[model samples]
Target chain A: MATFIGMPAFPEASARAVGDAQLRHNLRKATHTIRARRAAVVAEQPDWAGLRAAGAAIKDRTLRHLDVYLERLESAVTAAGGHVHWAEDAAEADRIVVDLVRATGETEVVKVKSMATQEIDLNAALAAAGIRAYETDLAELIVQLGDDLPSHILVPAIHRNRAEIREIFSGRMASWGRPAPEGLTDDPRALAEAARLHLRERFLRAKVGISGANFAVAETGTLVVLESEGNGRMCVTLPETLISVVGIEKIVPTWRDLEVFLQLLPRSSTGERMNPYTSMWTGATEGQEFHLVLVDNGRTSVLADRVGRQALRCIRCSACLNVCPVYERAGGHAYGSVYPGPIGAILTPQLRGLTGPLEESLPYASTLCGACYDVCPVAINIPEVLLDLRAKVVAGDHRAERLAMGAARRVLDHPKWLALAQRSVGRLRRWTPRHLPGPLSAWSDTREVPVPPRESFRDWWARRAGEEGGR
Target chain B: MSSRDRILARVRAALADVPRTETPEDVEVPRAYDRSRSGPDVVELLIDRLVDYRAVVREVTDVVAAVADALARRGAHRVAAPAGVPAAWLGGVQAVRDDPALSAADLDALDGVVTGCAVAVAETGTIVLDCAEDQGRRALTLIPDYHLCVVRRDRIVRTVPEALTRLDPSRPQTWISGPSATSDIELDRVEGVHGPRTLEVLITPAL
Candidate 1:
């Protein structure tokens, strides 16, 4: 799969989800627990708001001067004995990663869970080139064994529970060379153990490792991975060739900018002070070859937008996902793309563009609850960004959408016109059925349309203001 | 797109619409590091915070006995340490395992876990768990109840961002700012909800 770029629209994919009760149950339970924890811990610190502001500001400043900082980062990485490659998108990144692993003459590479690699569909690409890519991260391993795409950002397999996990591990782990023991149970600990035993073999044997960074330091040319598991350590060090794929947005201007994010990310995400594992590698070490692919893949297009540009600041901490009520109920798979949750809502549209069905519908996924913005470690105003994208989609081709807004503006510009509009709406409110006709019926299929008011709010407001004036 | 293509477009666009370069706008920031809140002070705060979370922090002069005593106190039956761990750090522990190749069964047999660090941050009162050297694999520290981490004072930094600067780009390095903890029941706090219950940090003045 070349990333789900050419997939059907989100509404089409979500229609499939409307019938699946299992996904809803898993998503609801997991998201609520994590959501409650994030709120409680976030409330502990009074400086959270300040920290968020600083994080947002720092990222804004860094992205503003990204050209200068990225060049500096490339130079710093090279001076540290690392090689840097610029990738336009998934294909370029895949080509570079495959070439690096091939140069080592190693057919097998162990991977640290990387969303960028997922964005490029790296494993499938590697398999096509006659190489095997093993996922060492526990959540990713389950996803790999199941031959399923990742539905969540932080926990890729959030859609699947322990029972589903056992089947994947027991049935498929061995075909990949590490089989689960017979009579595997659905206990998490047991499943984790099976994964551990299976992954340990590759960790000791792999000569190449692939990964993505949570943050990349421009001044130092350092790449950082904040994880709860130790598999990342096993894969990065054991491999002779370490290849890191990073988005241009992952950069922080300096160490000072890095601190604000580290605090904000952990607390908002796992509700911990810091992740259990934070890995940083500057370049090649002890005769290892280090290759960095700085992926642009629609990033420049995102950066070009005045409103949507804030998305490029994401650290991928997934704090927003843990907090989003919509994501909790709907689940990650409903979004039908790689980057799911709130980040996915805005980022997917910008990354791949709204050409596909899912892309156009993604910007509408949110309730604009503002919780995603509140918990965003980087302080991306998700609601504002979501609305901005909505305006782009609905009002798209300013000429076309402008026609609607213009008609709306004209009716609002005249009192008589407004009154006539109210009468028509009031009449329809009584006679019209709750469900609209045609594809528009999907809205009422899931929810009831509120009947229009007896009188326009403008008339009510004028009446109230007149009373106040008389007083 | 290649750098030339991207930058060339920017340059061409600048020829007409956007400024080639605007007057550099400098936003004012705090001039001085707050003396009351330094990296060392953050580390101190982190220690108090960790203690509040119920994990014990011990400042150690000799790491050998610190590791030995910590494990002895915890009554670890099977101990898993990072592969690059110095033999001296073991301090006569009979069952310590150094193989990165240890199966989960082998890891489970160990009474506890120990690992060396790539760096430590005093400001955050956190230890950087880079899977470097002897820091047994991340799971080694995570699966076991007692996490005995050896931190060198010099590795410590003042803030989370500063701490990130010291990390690598590729490998997974887990950051343990404090023992793992969570709270439920109207803000009733619980320790070791998922990860290590007892986090013993033996901070040494030097490696």
Candidate 2:
């Protein structure tokens, strides 16, 4: 739960990340592959622009009346024999989930890959409560087995190659459950097979399943999950009790609205025409029990800002991450949050509040090339929000900066003082250091200092006038 | 105050800029996207899309013979079929009826599963199962390593929007685009995962 709490600021983290040649290579190769595939598949849809527009508008409409839609969703889910709970923050959400699992009398639960649950740090909470949660997705399994933090939103273990995956499976699969096959190779097929064998037993015996929804239809009270592997199906269907921790923003007002997102998400996320499996269930099915926990967890605070709130429209497609130039070199781990990339740059600071060095530094993480805006399905103006957050940060503390700007304003207000300062800087040109001293070095570390000119423009203009008069 | 009440209040306060007279409908959503198809052959498109996902597709005049042939081709000995599935579809194989609702372990031991789809989308090559009698429970299609689905030509639609209209949201639904696959490894797709690794589709004329 505290994994990202005290991480260093973006500059330090990204500096370290860029130096790791393997990470940069992995990110470049993966992002480029997915980027080309997404472009090709997206091109196949002639109505893609229309779809993108409608997708953005629909999300806007939903957010504008989120209260109304959430009430309707709660009623619909209740009518369908599902229980609904509201959590104000991550701690409350974790407590609710842990209590639910404890009530089920099961010490272990199977899980589908869900960003909401990760944001809440549900796995760590479960472990603290003496309960175990197993991650069923191929990438999640790799991360869980390796005891690693997820780097990418879609591909959690995207940083790890096939060989590293084989090592994790062979070295660590035993204590969890079934061990990897003897002499397992680095082939993806073999690694996937090893995971299949490793987690199959847990899936069959799991009595409780935990998940997050891709979309929640308020009209029919149905929850939809789109995934490539059948592990999502196994987790949601095979378990007797299912708990879904969903962000308040995941709601779409009607079932028909799915047509827009269903077409948009798969192509944008994994570059597939449609993911292999999409499960939609309205509340409890036959012998199963369903619980829907609506988590605020700073989402309401995010919604309070009209300029920053557009970020809530994100469907977690990771398209922005794949297209971001800064993300390709620096990678996901550098962002220091479960959410990463261009979207993360704006989202993390807002959600966590620009309190510490990490949160404050996140807004400046992007180069603002606007690749994220173009690929965004919901059309979240990420750069606009980043600029907005930057203004908010500067307006806040930073006493020295404010004081320096005030002094500069004072000098500029008086023409005589401005001329005197320019003359002094010109005279001191030789003594100017390439890098600034003290705390100011942080700013100059990545930038070059421009040496002062030998003469002021005012002095040069006056001397030229005098020479012309003499002639 | 209750968490729900507080959260709702926060949402209302956040939208103070939005005029009270403006309703949710005030927001405009452009719907010019294609919801239906033109003259292209839908079946051909479905087949092409399915093949693109590495699914094994066969066009047959006789569904029963095709199903039997598909199972035989995989050398599948024990196949699980839902109650609503026609007995003839499993005539050539050792059919395991889901009357008792096979346990997860039992389903895992089976060679494969055969079922009928609610609808198939031509554009996305997706076949949806609503857990109708023929499709049984969701796990029936999962757990097993191989799946042979019977998608009737008449049940195919041209686009995702059209398919959505035909589906009942109340029913628990599973939309299968192809065999279970993953792109998690360096973003390279490798088919066959937790779901049926091999998905074989038999397209036949209306029953």
Candidate 3:
């Protein structure tokens, strides 16, 4: 619902980001630590490949018949005493959630760290409606307190170091609800304690909770959420009413499919044998009202493209982000979306449909190093989708590139034309400029032009043959 | 048409490539991953994994004595126990029972909670609670700062898949590994967050 409107394209944003020494240092340290942790845990599973394949296959099967699986999920959830709402887009989804919270007569709601809510900008929507939504996850809290946007999916404030976090907490925590303790330190443990004290009162008093699911089962009508802190548990459990906004692509056909994802996700996302907490609920627990909103916001369109549709198989592990060299240096903000990195390069363009310069440039954010594909738990071939998006961008725009390509194709089609052009270039080699004129100079700015030889290879070969015959 | 119908129609139109006759089972999902593990030392393995997550674990022959000793060591005076938990396990502490079902504020006021888990997984060193009578509601074990769970040796399974077979999907479940932790700050692990900061488990011999 909230677009990254007027944000500079990836190159411009990343150009500025690369010059920030503190930002680069923070990104390098965080990503390298997570990458090594993921590698170690992944190696422990001898059948990790099998599990990854199964995870991909399950998602594919569900996506192919998404209509059917969604129908089943709706019916099952209804039977289990939960209400389901269908949203055609972000505006519709936000309207549904705000209406639900309004019906409950609550002005404040506690939140779990959910990407779907972020994608739709739910908190901003609620704020506009005069309701406050508090983010409970540590990283999310840090981002919120600093008045900053999330950079990474798992750790939204990955760009901020411990000292900066301390500054944000000590300076901003009071305005939110609870103030920081007297003289808070930069040590992580102390920072966590301050958050615990601040949010504990809200958790005890909050009447409503909002979340996004890691996996939703069609067969059993279950929703699964994985997290490290007890904040997720408090939000989902202690509240009187719970609302979960989930993407339709998150559905799995059977309950047993969690075995594959519950293994692959933790190892891939946090590099843990298992995260500290995982909560599963079929429907409304005793004394709690439940609502499930199935959002088709830009997902059905993503499902339409055959090559681009694999992006739907993503579980939002952020493994691809951590392993991306381009992401490491350029940082997450440059991509200009709630989602970033290699996955974002392909996903954001498809979700938003190459709407502007920002969307068009996202597909070129990667170096096609294939590290993202190798680390992807669901095994989304990100580079393949990226190349597909790039081709589409070129076909849709770039008039000069199209003209140059057309001319090259015509010359390549005819041998005489190509040879004549080659000889003319060889004769005028000394007059060649190091950089091209006009818009073409953008390509040559960071590269050198090769000097042409005096003669063509074909002419040299023909002369040798004639001299041998003469001898 | 309703938004649901329109969205579903859009989905159907988008999936025009999928043959109409095709069923969900037409796609093959290869599940060759290890489903079950076998060995005699599963209890020992559970202890090793639980300790790896920084949970204090003890293999005790006497459940009652161990539970009491753990509470005493932590100096937990206002300990809470579910109605179904055996009274013998709480002899030494000021055992508060959830007979009327304590409120969130009430649970937060207590020092700790002791409950019996439904199942345990050795590979991940995780414990699951189904909110049965003995385990109480989700908030009982959550609101307090310290949690001491009793895991009978027989309930321990070798792998995650094996553990799933023994539980009911209909019941709300919470799977906990070690204490609450976060790696969000500079990607360094700092244990003890909103959940029980201290997790102590007593693995007793099966009845």
Top TM-score hit: 3
Sort every candidate by TM-score, greatest first.
3, 2, 1
lDDT (Cα, tens digit) per residue for candidate 3, span A1-471: 235657798988998999999999999999999999999999987789999999999999999999999999999899899999999999999999999999999999999999999999999899999999999999999988888888898998999999999999999999999999999999999999999999999999999999999999999999999999999999999899999999999999998898899899999999998999999998888678999999989999999999999999999999999999999999999999899899999999999899899998898888899999999999999999999999898899967677788999999999899889889999999988899888777556646877888998888988999999999
Sort the predicted structures by DockQ, highest score first.
3, 2, 1
Which portions of model 3 show Cα errors greater than 4 Å?
Answer: A1-3, A415-435, A445-471, B38-40
Summarize candidate 2's per-residue lDDT along A199-280 as a digit string, tens digits.
Answer: 8889999999999999999989999999988899989999999999999999998988999999999999999889999999
Candidate 2: Cα lDDT at B50: 98
Give each model's whole-structure lDDT. 0.72, 0.92, 0.93
In model 1, the Cα lDDT at residue A143 comes to 80
Ten-residue segment with the worst summed lDDT in candidate 3 chain B?
B32-41
Return the top candidate by DockQ: 3
Name the better of 2 and 3 by lDDT.
Answer: 3
TM-score of model 2 relative to the true fold?
0.95
Question: Looking at candidate 2, what TM-score does chain B attain?
Answer: 0.97
Cα lDDT tens digits for candidate 3, B1-207:
998999999999999999999999998899989898566599998999899999999999988889889998998989889999988888878988998989888999999999999999998889999988879889999999999999998889988888888888899999999999998899889999899999999999997
